[model samples]
Target: MDVMQRMERLVEQLNQYNYHYYTLDQPLISDKEYDALYDQLTALETEAGMALPDSPTNRVGGELLKGFKPHRHLSSLWSLDKAQNEEHLLNWNNRALKLIADYNSKNPDSPLPAPTYVVELKFDGLTLNLTYSDGQLVQAATRGNGTVGEGILAQVKTIKSVPLSIPYRDGTIEVQGEGIMNLSVLAKYNETAVEPLKNARNAAAGALRNLNPRTTAERKLSAFFYNVGYSDGISFADHREMMEFLKDNRFKVNPYVTYFDSFDGVMQELHSISDNRSSLDYLIDGAVIKITDMRTREVLGYTDKFPRWAVAFKFEAEETTTVLESVSWNVGRTGKITPLAKVEAVELAGVTVQNCTLNNAGDIERKNLKFALGSRVFIRRSNDVIPEILGKVTDEQDGEEIIVPEHCPACGFPLEQRGAHLFCNNRLECKPQIVARITHFASRDAMDIETFSEKTAEQLYDEVNVHEPSDLYTLTYEDLIKLERFGEKKANNLLDAIEQSKGRDLASFLFALGIPNTGKSTTKVLAEHFRDLTAVMSATEEELTVLPDIGGIVAESIVSFFADPFMQASIQKMLSLGVEAKAPEKSSAPVTDSFFSGKTVVLTGTLHRLSRDEATERLEALGAKVTGSVSKKTDLVIAGEKAGSKLAKARELGIPVMENEEEWIKLLDGEQN
Candidate 1:
């Protein structure tokens, strides 16, 4: 098929997939298969130099806009009157019934029916108005002054459930919905976000209002349509019919819409929605009740600020302003200090909150909390998350400044500034650092040292001078048996665990070493790249940065660590005490079970074409055990540039060796061929 035809077909398929997955919650295709199709379409578009008008790729705005334009809405988006209590709700019902009675009395022969109510969730998000023209999405805006709003068409396009085009092509229509970030999506984003969003409401509103459309796309927003604000050629008989019309046109109408025949039923549904809102994926501040009959709404409508037909039954508020009485610093496993705010006890979202996180020192400055101590600050508590300090109530510097600590709060060591954080570098003398390092080393993903705990690390540090991880290898019955409440079996078990830890694979050993700015995935990549502990330790930053996942910061951390004399001595001592850190063997590497099989090989210096790791891998693939040193039992040695003492010793021991790069590679290559 031609490129344009192919692109059109792909866009239609992907949009249908998106509708099923996002709106209907029923995925028609697996993620991998969908991605493959998407990739093919993206390549074709790139090849053709243009994307189809309805392409899913339009979700990302090609460029940032300077500012939002004012959107003059076709129909004014009216606000709903709020009912804070059952009495206020009853008053609203009485007013609606009275209006209907007056209209019926005037028309005597044709009377309005008793009002049935349509109840829906009042979503706690920014109100969005979307306009569609001739089957295609044309504009999106925020509800600004009821009649005029700020255009956010690019931002709204990022919402996958908002169809770029609809089935209705005869005329234009405007649909109203709430733009929101799902609670689960917000939680997941916060898990890895550098600056976590304080709450879902602000996160959604701020993203949609942002000048950069990329920000909106990254937030993964969703929307639920409830009203057709303006329609040129279509009309509904009732609220249910309007909702059905919205759904038929592919709008994501909220499924919580319920019809209640009586005011008591509406009240019950309101109570039920408020009670069960905590279980919902999105946040809702209340439930809304609207007159179901279109004719009844027409007769009772037209208030200055709110429609007489609908009222929002608001639940309790979740945010409050509180006095920031004090601030305290707490240290974590990585020696990074975090600020915790002590606020005046305030009940919020069903809990009394006294403490909230200030995130970090930079965050304190960014939030203008440096001078907010003993001042009123805005705080919010979501249902399950810890309460957060949003900001100071005002920009006025009316209170004491929160001082940044120059020394570690726990160990009194000098603190060093790194990026937005302060770190304590006294790894040897700091109590928390030592304790945490030991505890992390014994973690399941690390060395798997059984019966080890932070309490045990603290006790060991206090009783014996176990300042470094290597010190664990030296513990004995004499050391452990003297500790308080230490039984014979306990000491033996501890020693056995320490002994067993020596055999942990290279990746786990690297992770147990606790290099800063590195994670398990990074250590695993390092193990795969270097394949030998000595090679990894000796890897230069230039070499390290070339490997996958090894960025400048992590490479620098690894280099700086191994270059330290104390750290070097500790690792050497561990090896001397019989720690055997080796790479995990790959079973799929081509195995040449020939001459190199059952042979002990020694690799010294570095080949110009291949790294020491490469040579070691080939030797191991050929069934050779690559050792670090030359000895009488060593059968062969492959030496490269600046071959030193190990190479000389191999010559002295009369061990067969290949010193030329060409001959060495040829011999290894011949066996594999």
Candidate 2:
């Protein structure tokens, strides 16, 4: 077949698989089979030498929103000043102690008791700032710029994990929460992953950022509302009771949260939480320990970032021992080789540490890691990050070194030695290299092939002669069904996906191509400026040097990628496949103007934005400063109709009010440039 016919067929085949996996959640083609087709296309395009803008390789992160609209947070969201270590935490406790002492000195008859500390898991996910008015959900946003954020209320509601409305009535409440994705879910997703997600945090972040709320919903994103941002009608004497009341109201509270009276107790629980963190399904980076007494908490108040009463206690990296079963090396897009240690499963922190990344040849050699056919190796999970091997124990070891491969495991190409690393020079000919390249191309931050799971990707590798993403359009349903675990229904679905993927946004397509160091955000900037992949490829390294965030390293990577024979061939294949690499339709909104500009606004109701991040980002961009509570310094209060105490306080403080989205947006429009 001619190149054009081969490319068109390749696009058709790959689209079917993409649709079945991403949209329908049913995969037809085995991953390895799909990869083989992608490989052929990549090779052809490289040979032909051109970039296809609409090829699955492009859809990653796009242009930054010109500027987000500002919404006033009903409660001013403050950042927690960090307590770096136990010493800092102890000092904070002492400060709290002194504050209580001074309070008792003023009121001798009714002295406040010793303060208790509440400790909860500090999730590493995005921060969700929420406002509730009269027991109804209002604004939800991210903690963008700490003061304003993108408004994503419509999208936030779609997450079944976040309650649409609070259970209580006749009261206003402000809540702080964490949006979390479990490690197990991430693992399950990665198990079938074409390219395993880097970590759960990245997965959750990507899922949260998706424009399609349905995608967020399918991710099973969950939230834990830990703090009352602002509230009326209901009051808690302490943080513990507040959490309890939040749970009583059906908010998904963190169950591991507890209260302690002494620093020793706090320390003990910190250790306990750290020891058991991996056992929990969700990912947690540290523990948040907060003062319980509201009265004392008020005196302690907050800094610009975090609450003075609260501090996150991060656990030290933990190390454990596991038996090294095998050593395998995987080829990377840069042609660098990474050694992986396969070990018998052993518990560490909360989850089982099974496999660890050895990084490179230098890493393997530096540790003197000679694994007996079955000897114990010391495994360490550093600060809840991906586990790695610190060293090997040769003392009375049970296993000997498992030989590292001299050639590519998938394509049988001779490996090349480059200072402390092994390289697969086979480029387009190697199956492992091709599959990895294609999978990286379709990743969320890359081309964003949502349905490309590891299992399917592997099947494509093992079954189909297909090697890269561009080759996907060339496969037939029969080819897909021949792979293990794929039937006719599944095969048809995979075929359908390949068809749909042809029309994705341009930035996403660039990201899918798996160029080294060139991620989603970078892709967006380049796509917007160049307007097409052809321009990008034709541009000189010097021309790319001036772009924002694109420095010497990134510019070098981009230039090197375009210079590669394989990349050139893949681009041609994409063109032949009829992939359109053009910039997406731009939003008409002015880049500078925003609603909150030059306004001192107080938020006093539930918001439609995702959380405080949304509201903060909006307000900041438009030149508005959002404060926590109503005070003499306040200017205007944007009360979302059903605002609670802050609303009343605003009135008492004689602040001007814009009662709804119409008036608020109108007032904002009047202030804009």
Candidate 3:
């Protein structure tokens, strides 16, 4: 076949495989076969220098957008009215019955019967609207403000469960659904995530809003179509029929839906759902009870913000009352002191809860949680493994006050207070701090030293006299073999791992240094900008601050770290031991000036296309000074996914903002306003 014909055939076959595997829950082709075809198609598209709009390659993501464009929804996606208690639900039912009775009285000859309700699980996730034209998936948006939403077609296309094209052709059809990350998916993601998501709802929301479709694809999100927002040349007699049609057209419909003629039957299903919620794969905050008949729904209509035809019966928070036995202070890897509340053992969310995180000293003060011994307190557990103290339940104030430690609990070093956090300043001598530093150095994101554990660090610290990061390089296999459970083979393996880590990239080495206020991203910026260790060591605070995302605080911290005699000695020792800190090669592209010329730019959040280091290099090449924090001095801010405090602060300071990769590229090419 010719290239165009071959490409067309591959698209059809790949999409068919996707449908069978994702929508039908069956695979007609082996993964290897599918991948081979996909690779061929991608190669053909690249060679042609053009790609079909609906090509399966788009699922891997194409060009990063500057920002999401506003899409006015064809039909308003109204929220469901809520009810908390059984009494409130009954009251709502009574109102609905009364409305039906009034309708019957108005039309005496054609009397309306009591409305049968369709009950479905109210999935705790981000609401999405998918529009299909001529059986092809076209537009997908978030339910931003009911009338208007942000277009997220590319991200939505990544969801395999959502059909790229449906069987029905002609006219636009809008399907409203909940975009959710199953609990299993969330658990799997958390196993590798640096920061575990609080809950599945947040995880789903974050994934859907992510700038990169590849990220959304990696998240393995699912969608359940619950309602039809708009449909042309088709109609359903009831909600159940509509859901059936959606399922037939390759859209996922909620499996746990039932029809009820009375409120009592609906209540029974709600009770059953509540009892089995823990066993479910997805998070459901509540149960939605809606009038089943389409004609009945029209008669009920909607309020300003909510539909009168449906009511969400919200479930009570998962909380239990427990006694606060005592409080314990624990030191973390960063030497930050955290308060752990030793609560009386109680069962919460299918787990036995004894200790709860009090966060920090500020949290205790803000919550006014009098850590009075034997005081009754309410504890709540969300999707996180750790439980948190909600509030005190009793008025028993006759107990000892919890005190913040002035010294480190482990090393007895004086604790230094910075903002709301307290840290141990003894980085060199403190045993726990030293071990944490070593563990962090060997962590996956840093040096990626395999088989290095906290236990290993502790053993090395006590037995091998490994006080500093550089000391690890000096250890002989004989030194490790002396430790318990350390055979000759194990010792050699560990020594080999350590040797391998010595050749890690400069960014990794910089992060392994554990410089205060310098994270992985910041370390990348430093490595890319400074080029070499010596340059970084000799850099002034002013010079450091001029780099992207290196604010005054980080600049000062880097300067102080290099200036410290102990740190300087450690770096020199590592260098002498043949630790190679290779700098990133400079880009070959010539420098150009547009808006970024001599501008003070700050970047925040996760970028879709460029790493923080690459973005910094691009800005710097254009004579831009990339700073960390937002201030009046900041000329521009490049905001990306989850751009939080810095983005807000930039707006407060009236700084111009570029929200995505496309805008940054356009500005660099002198093509943007």
Candidate 4:
């Protein structure tokens, strides 16, 4: 088929698939089949130099925008008055009752119906208003001032759940929803994300407001439509009817919406929702209660700021204001110095908050915590993780300045600033840096030195003057048994483990070297690409950057790390001591430039060529992190027949997948070649 015709067909198919997977929570095809079609569609779009407006490829943004344009909403997106506690909610309900009673008394012949309510979760996310015309989503905006807002159509399109088109094509309509990032996605993102997100709310909001729509797509935002703000072709008699219309039109409606005949029932449901909010994947700050009757809402009308028919029952605050007492700097294993804020003991999110991560020197300055000592600061705890300081409660800088150390906290070596972080260059004299390096070298993913611990490294460091990784190899049983904690058996076991690690593959050995900005995936790629220690150590920054997963920073780090004469000497010494960091044989080497190289892949279903164990080994040998389950971190999935939830999940996540058994065999064949 021609590119245009083929592109059109692919777009229609992919859009339907997206609607099914994201909105309907079901998949009609395997991830592999869908990905094949998607890959073809993307290739055609690239060849044609254009993508259809509704293409799934557009779900991820292209380029950065210069600025946002203003969008005048079709109808005003009114805010809801807030009720903070039981007393406030009761007062609001009583006021609504009084208004209804007064209206009923005036219109005795044609009285309004008794008041009922529709309760929905108040999503703690950025408010989004989408305008559609003739079944096509035309514009999306923020609720800047109800009437006028920033247009973010491209950013909003990145939300897979937000339909690019709908069944309703008669005229224009406006739908109101909240854009949110799921907490689970956030956690998964933080696993490999260079800069981890602080909280879901900020992550969602910041992504939507970012100049680049690509940032929005990276956050994996979801949206739920709740209000038909403006509809030229349709109207609803109640909130329930409006929600039904939205769902029928393929818009995502939150399932938590419920109608109640009595305000007491609504109140009870609100409490229940708040109690179970922690179990939800998305953030909800409170419950929204609105009068269900459209006519009743018209009679009640709107206040200057909010709709008189609705009120937001706000939940208790998770954030707490605490006084910043001091800031402490500590060196991590990477030799990077991080700042830790010491706050006054305050209760927040059911935990006593004292210390919080300041991230780095740049973070402290950006958060305005550089001069925040003795000032009250806002702190938040998320997902049971460590509490983090948001910023000072006020912008006033009338406080003691947080000191930046010129020397390392662990050792007396001069500290140098690298971007936002400070690092110590003393790999030999610095006790903590060397100890941390050795500890990391013997860790599981690295050399797998069994029974090795930081305590053992510390003991060796202090007593035997063992400072570097090579120092450990030079030690004998006599050297280890002399330590306080080491018995004869313990010493012998440790020595054996160290000896066994000498035969670890080149990839593991490279990872154990503790190169900054280089992760396991990068190290594997390095091993696969160079295949020898000498070549990898001699690789240039430009050459290294061309390899998979190795960016400029990682390239520079690798070059700088290996260039050190001391590092070269240490490696030579380890080699002389019988550390055989051997490269795989020519035929057994991973395809250095394969698509799967350096990607975290998951294999599911039945394989025709090999068992799961053999496939995993081949994938690992091919430089892929073979995992058991599919997550955001998974880069690919090779599915066979009867591929179950894992394959479906891969489809839902837009992961690259292929179920072609013939192609699988070809790849396995290449492993032998």
Q: Can you write out model 2's per-residue Cα lDDT over 1-673, one digit (the tens) per residue? A: 9776677677556655654443223468888998887788777677767534323322222333333356666667776656667898888788778878887999889788788887777887878887777666677777777667766554455444455445587777777787777766765664444434545565677776677665565566666678887777777788878877776665666556666778899887776666555556666777887888887777777765667777777664356678788888777766777888788988875577888878776655555565454776777685457787756656444557667778877568788887767888887677666667767766655555557776677678677866778888677887888788888888887777766677777787878777678877788788888888888887787888899889898999888888988779978997788667657676445335555556677875556633554655466557777777666667888766335446544653457877777766665457554
CA lDDT of every candidate: 0.86, 0.69, 0.82, 0.85
- Residue-by-residue lDDT tens digits, candidate 3, 1-673: 8888888888888888887777655578899999999999999998888767667887767666678899999999998788988898998888888988999889988776668988888888999999999988889999999999999998898898888878888699899999999878976785556444555776789888888777788889988888888988788889888987887787877556778888789998787666655446787778899889887788878777787788999876556788888888887767888889998898876678899988777666555565566777777676455887755664456656787899999889999998768888887778888898889988888888899999999989998888878889998977988899999999999999999988988999989989988998899888888789999889998898788778999999999888999888998898889889888877655444456777899998768887887788777877788787666678999988656446645764567998867867777667223
**TM-score of each prediction:** 0.58, 0.46, 0.51, 0.59
* Cα-based lDDT at residue 474, candidate 3: 95
Per-residue CA lDDT of model 4 for 417-476, tens digit only, reads 988789988767777777889999999989999999998888889999888899889999
Model 3 misplaced regions, further than 4 Å: 47-49, 319-673
- In angstroms, the error of model 4 at 576 is 1.1
Per residue, candidate 1 scores C-alpha lDDT tens digits across 372-420 of 8899998876557788887777878999999999999988999998887
Please list the residue runs of candidate 4 whose C-alpha ends up more than 4 Å from where it truly belongs after superposition: 1-122, 126-174, 179-224, 227-320, 346-351, 585-673
Q: For model 2, what is the alpha-carbon lDDT of residue 521?
A: 70
Q: What are the candidates' C-alpha RMSDs?
A: 18.6, 24.7, 20.8, 11.5
Q: Which candidate is the best by lDDT?
A: 1
Best by TM-score: 4
The better candidate by lDDT, 1 or 4, is: 1
For model 3, where is the 10-residue window of minimal lDDT?
A: 586-595
Question: Which ranking of candidates, highest TM-score first?
Answer: 4, 1, 3, 2
